[model samples]
Target: MMTQNLLVELLVEELPPKSLKQLGQSFAQLLAASLEAQGLMNQNAVVTAFATPRRLAVHIGNVAAQAADKAITQKLMPVKVGLDAQRQATPPLLKKLASLGADASVVPQLKRELDGKTETLFWDSIATGTSLTDGLQKALQETITQLPISKVMTYQLADGWQSVNFVRPVHALVALHGADIVPINILGLQAGRETQGHRFAAKVNPIALHNADSYAQQLSTEGAVIASFAERRAEITRQLTSAASQEQLTLIDDDALLDEVTALVEHPNVLIGKFDAAFLQVPQECLILTMKANQKYFPLLDAQGKLANKFLLVSNIRPIDPAQVIAGNERVVRSRLADAKFFFDQDRKKTLASRVPELDKVVYHNKLGSQGLRMHYVRAIAKMIGEQLGGDALANQAYEAATLAKADLLTDMVGEFPELQGIMGRYYAQHEGLDDDIALAIEDHYKPRFAGDELPCKPIGVCVALADKLATLVDMFNIGEFPTGDKDPFALRRHALGIIRILLEKKLPLKLDELIQQAIKIINDDAILQQWENSSNSSEGIAVRRMALTLTNHAYIAEEVPVLHKKLQEFIYERLAGSLREQGYTAQEVDAVLGLDPPLPLILKDILKRLVAVRAFAILPEAISLAAANKRVGNILKKAKTEGFDNLSLEELSLHLRSDPQEPAEQKLYNALIDISDITNTALSTDDYVTFLQAQAALKLPIDDFFDYVMVNVEDKVLRNRRLTLLANLHSLMNRIADLSKLAT
Candidate 1:
């Protein structure tokens, strides 16, 4: 076996900028994986992926020219089936051997082996390895077939009658092993040593690569291209930073835009461009979005974090005089900014309150009615939450904010850029001279849009945010739109997580179950259902009428709402558990804390405290023994209940016990429980979970001794029930903070 570095490249028309990064990565990964699976490449081989606007290429080190030959043993038919009574070949066995490229002369050499209860014949042979030429052909075909191409283009090749489908039109293919060109063909292109680079700035029209190792250097020097995506992005970052620093401005940090820009250019030249300062009169968010989304330009911010007049553009070409390029980009951006300013000016002509009627025409969901109906549900939910949190004053403010929240969906600015829905609402509300709290709530209601995003900054905002997210979650789940596996089309998981983050992070006293019930009640109200039926007779209204009928039918609502509530509760807790584990808590610790009975407090804020207490208790010297004892107690109580002791009460525990201990171990356990009962109660009263759990250490010794000496299932009925009552009290005390038995390994 001989080894050599290999290079593979596919030259095509300009690729999609947003998908180029993934395309490049997948191409290289799939190729290398296929080769390794065939034993033509080592697992530790170094692989480098190269992606530019016009090419996808890869270089792999230490790839064998041919895979190693392997020895194989394959089971043939049973001996009786393969051989006649005289031990001669039968027609079926001869045909089977012929299919394997063997003949009857070798039948005598076959070995006999027992397979299951029957004797079987086995064939041993050496399999030849696959040559690089054939292996690379298969790898290339598999890679192309498996590329993550969302959409494919069907184009005819140079041959008039033949057509091929690919992400882009393929122009050339190059495959090399060291200095030799490996023969391969794909997409109507043959492997070669030539590839075009840079499109216009190349020193050579088609640069000829010398070898697998020289491909990158040759392309960089002669083709005027940076072949590596990461290296190209780094260069762009360096240039942008240097240019921004020269003018004492900061560049807006967006990795997605940076990657897209990197994929759009081969030779990145960061040029500073400027627009009229008057354009900055628009909100910085609006201006920044236009620049980045419309023109793919990086906007710079001044010292106060305000948008500056200058922006940085990544150009594909560098000229001796960069003034013209700068001016050209500035002209394009100025046009985009003027359109944004025009939309802003037009939208401010009417207040957000006036835009409320327009949302009726916008369908939120077919089954949920229009945005107008959803607005009512959210308003009702928000008012209830506000009343619970801050009484009448906050309730009025939240109602007002929730009313105006979706009003922005009709504004010209938001219609043009849907990302600015809540954002534009805040601005319009402020322009109308509304209360600062109400205006802030309009925008912050959509806060924490993604993971690690900031929550609402004010109490009013928190109330409305929770209301909006809850409304969506309950309605979607009601319509059977909950997420299944990785398919969360409605983002229900995100909505649940957002609600959890606000409640826990803000330490709001609101209960999770209560919020869900409030949402369900508001959406299912008769008045709300009547409004849906009377609103209109359009298809949306028809759908809403069906839904309203389902909600108003007392039998259906009674049966479904509780089930819906339990589902929503479980959904939230699941999200919370995953989030806790991600925060570094072990699964056992999370399980122990969350496994309490439903009647117990499931307050989101207290969950973290309980988890912290569990973590601390898990490290104590007596923690393991206590956990095991708790588990044993739980099992014994469960068994007793199933044995017709379900009504055993702790109030009658003393009644069943003798004046003195019937068994020494039982008395010791009884005394231990008495000693810690008051201590645990006092600790629990003050929310001292750590103290409550730690106090259990005193009972571990007596518990172990009792289990060892006392028979819980004794023949005497009175003694058995007495022991059951004692264990029930212990189980109740041990699980007050968490189900410690879950911590038992």
Candidate 2:
């Protein structure tokens, strides 16, 4: 088989910057995967992805001109159904062979094999290799079809009557095998060697690629474009660093922003721009966000990590003078910063407390009433959590923070930039001479907005943060807005994970079930319901009134609260299981710890200790035998219960054991359990799970002997019941730390 490097490119209108990186990587991977599946490319072939604002391309090394032929064996029908009494092919066999392009002459060549007690016939054939032209066409079509495009645009082709749907309108397609053009068509465009590049700065209008290997070099030399997304991003980073170093400042580090900028320009030329120093009076968050979100510029920071007056911008075209370009960017950014400053100044004119009344006009959810009503729920929950965690002082601070948390939604700064909701509240609170704890809590309550993000640093902040996330989870689950698959419009999974992270990482002595119950109670309180009813009736909007009525109706909440608690509990545990696995714990270890039932309250603070203890116990020499023994004992108890032993009290079942034990194995096991009872109880009382589990290793020999020499199902009813009760007690002692049976395998 002859092989050559392959290059493919699709030219179109400027692609979305945010999705360009993913789109390029997907295109290359999907194309290479398709070729590998078709046997036209090796599994280890090197695949390079190229993406810019206007194109997505890939270069795959060592793709064959045609795939190697493969030998295949396919199963036919069973011999009993296919062969006649005389060992001749039946009509069905003939039809099957005919469908496979075979005839009766080849019937003797069919192989016979046993397929689950019945002899089956097998047909062997050689499949022809796929030519590069056909393979590339199929791969290209499949890749385009599978691209992770969120939205597709439908547009008419040059023919005017024919239309095609794609992420953008197709302009040209390039496909090359070595130096030869592969004859492939996609999106109504035929493959060619010509492609347009660098709309304004290209040395040549249409750079004619000479071969597959020359694609990148030719684009750089003649097209005035850096085709590789990563390479372009590196150049921008290098230039930004060099420029910032010369000015004694550092650029704000944001990889997502860097990737977006890389996708926005083909030739990145980093240039310095400046804004008025007066704008620094506003919060640095406001200034940095305005620059990044609106103008896509990198805000420079000083030595102390404070925002500098200067910023860096990447330009698509490099000019010799560069003065006009720098001036133009400065002008645009100055206007944006001015707008941000104006919003900030206007917002602080009134304190956050004064803006609380306006939240009623803002609907949090149509079915959940207004933000004002939601605030009431959050304040109550926060105060409850604070009271539990701290004393009345922390509770008062949490209530104050929760009361004003959503007030910033009405501010000019937050209204213009919704991302600044809690941030502006913090700033406004500070301006009003509020306590530092309260101000910080207002901002930090939304802490851990995503995975691995920090939790609230203070007790008051932790309370409000927990309350906010819990309220969201309970309310969303109550309304049946449960997240299904990847469609988490309300981000319930994120909310659940946030709550789990806070509870576990903060080491707060809070029980998962308790917090959930408290949140449900607060939301369903009659006082809160009455408040919601009054607000809804006074509001002018009919939708608001109807939603409030639905929410206040006690019957709807009563039916949903129990289901919501169970579902939310399961959801949180599921997230915790996944998080634990990601942190490198084995599935068996996680399962054993998480498999506890209703008696256990799922104390988040102690889950890690339990998992650590389980991991340590798993490595013990006696762990496997004890785990298996536990499983056997469980089965015996379950059988005994099924045989009407369930109604017998432990005293009734163990009545004969008070006198004497008939079996030595049972006596040895019973004595061992008694010996370890005090030690295990002390260990458990101190929450020393490792010591508790380690103490059980002493029972391994006796437990194995009991299971081997003792017949638990003896015909003597009293003896059998006594053994069953002994096994039940052993099961309880063994599983106090974790379900050892999950580790049996």
Candidate 3:
């Protein structure tokens, strides 16, 4: 057998748990490549790995003893002493070969020109074998430099040496070929028969590993340590499940939490720990978060499906008294619960809505403004959305929700734990007995904190959510927070995505500029709010109502409104286009359809359904001929001077169609024009955009013939004008489906 029983190990400082598995995998690859490079592997070999947070080790068995001798072909000049010009081995070639081992008697040299190069060649097998010692040395040296390092470090392995780079400071290494230690330096430690067991478990001076299998057994016998993560995990689960069964309680499934638990110990021993049942008075989420997030304990669910007030703690070491270990863990969990209760109770002191004014002191962003300012922005846009939806019931609820939506930010509970922003708002609103719609909207404003979560459900909630997100987007835009590629540091993309979901799902009737102006007015505290205060008294409710109304109104109602209103429309259009494409429309179709009406959903819905459906009926000769007519007229107009297109005159239709009924061009043009009114009416009645496209297609053949049969450019001004007028009428009718000529197939 080749010195096959080989064990190799890489010992290092603690490795990141997530990175350890892959690192272990790479070590085996490096070793395999070295073996393959030196041609050392054979059929009987096997390689395996054992990893821990602290070290990665590899073992190979039944390895080859020595490399197989390699065979190579050589081409040498042919020797000729008594050969004819026929090109065969001569007596001189035979004499030279006989000198080696009488092989000349059987061997022959031949001459032939190959690939434009003439050569005489003699074949011989050259066997080169490698010694076990030489091959092992070279393989070890080659692997050292190529080893993957976590961060890259230097550690010396030579006797009385200084430093060299390594993944970590290696405490020791072990490598063996049967009874003898294989000498190789890795991370400042020479490989040998000795390897340590679990650090804390077998902190003995040094442990001797007699052979391959003894490495694991000898260490365990020496100390209560199990280093294999998989084995440790299985043992922990078995114990925890068994313990929970004994108590008639079920354990919650938490794979992610268990992974963290696995990384913490070399030898895992699951122990049941308990705390006062009264502490369960806190909400279950807080209790679980406290145990798992703070204490790393698995919670037990009771027979009634409520939290059992019990926890499972996986320990690295067996304590002298198991009860003492349980007690210590309970104490820590209790302290966390106490803190949670304190914060929860303190939050109940003041109503969340009443605390809104306090947000003025809180900074949202250094450049973006304060939390109070953000509230004004979100509220203004919310009210605007309410008006857009045009329902007094929903609009009223939305107005109230917007004013109180961000009130939780000022609450002590939220301040203590910012993650509880919406949760605290829900709790505080319920405590104050606010309208359920208002309370729900207040809590659900931030419904989708991430993509693919959930959007607000109720109309009031949806409107306010849209308003809040819009205000944030506009403020960021005003401050120049445009996103590029993958880097939306402020999450502008997320805000845009939320806006799209709100519009698409709620299908709200909204004008993008009206919404943006509301957003801008919310943030325009200096411009609009300054004017409102000058003309109105804050104490008078009547003046407040009037000022609120005046704030959202625009002078021209379109042109004189805020610039961000237009910017918002542009943004909404892009987002709408992208969203519709995701819903399975071509990009150009979305642009063409969305372009016909304002994005105010009511207007879009009013016009888009008919327009879209009309396109479907437009497919026959009507649509084809119309598309053709528009294409012809467009091509002619395009080729003509870049000046204005001549306006159509019915006098030309009078001259051509009526004067000469036999004229093919004029006859075809008259028929196509006759269908325009009926075609548009049929498409509109069907409510199918496809019908409209089909109708346009019907016109294609006649339109093509009209342009082909007649000379549109004539020496006489009257005839040319008449043909051009007929073409213009065709373009006007065909454009309803789409600017057919602008479409590129």
- Best candidate (score: TM-score): 1
Against the true structure, candidate 3 reaches a TM-score of: 0.65
Q: 1-745 in candidate 3: lDDT tens per residue?
A: 3555666666567766555655666776677667766676654467776666666666666655677788755444433342447745566665655554445444543333342354455455655666555666666556656666557766565565678676667777777666667666655566777666666666563677787656556656774555555666677889889999988999999977776677667677899888888877665666777688778899999988799878899988776778888888888888988887787777778887677766655666555445665676577667767776866777778878987888888765566567777767877787789877788888778877786878887778887888778877866666556777888887877787787767655555665555566666666545554544454333243233334434544322334345656666677667766766776666555654565422333333333453354345343435444444556677776565354445556665766567756458667766766766686678657655565556555565676676577787777565656666676677656555456543333
What lDDT would each prediction earn against the true structure? 0.89, 0.88, 0.66
In order of lDDT, best first, we have 1, 2, 3
lDDT of candidate 2 over 688-727, digit per residue (tens): 9999999999999999898779988888876777787788
Better of 1 and 2 by TM-score: 1
- Superposed model 2: Cα runs more than 4 Å off: 68-128, 532-561, 642-658, 661-665, 708-722
The candidate scoring highest on lDDT is 1
TM-score attained by model 1: 0.96
Collision count of model 2: 0
Task: State the lDDT at 423 in candidate 3.
Answer: 66
Tens digits of per-residue lDDT for model 1, 1-745: 7899999999999999999999999999999999999999999999999999999999999999999999989888999999999999999999999999998998988999999999999999888899999999999999999999999999999978899999999999999999999999999999999999787899997988999999999999999999999999999999999999999999889999999999999999999999999998999899999999999999999999999999999999999999999988889998999999999999999988887877777888766678887888899999999999999999999998999999989888987899998898888888889998898999999989999999999999999999999988888877777798899988889999999999999999888988898788888776765665576444465466456548544312657788888888899889999999999999999899888864464788998999989988898899999999888888877777777874457556655555646888998887899899899989989999999999988988898999889988989787887888788888898898889988999
Those runs of model 3 whose alpha carbons end farther than 4 Å from true positions after fitting are 1-12, 15-52, 56-259, 265-277, 298-324, 511-514, 531-642, 647-687, 690-745
Task: Judging by lDDT, tell me the better candidate of 1 and 3.
Answer: 1
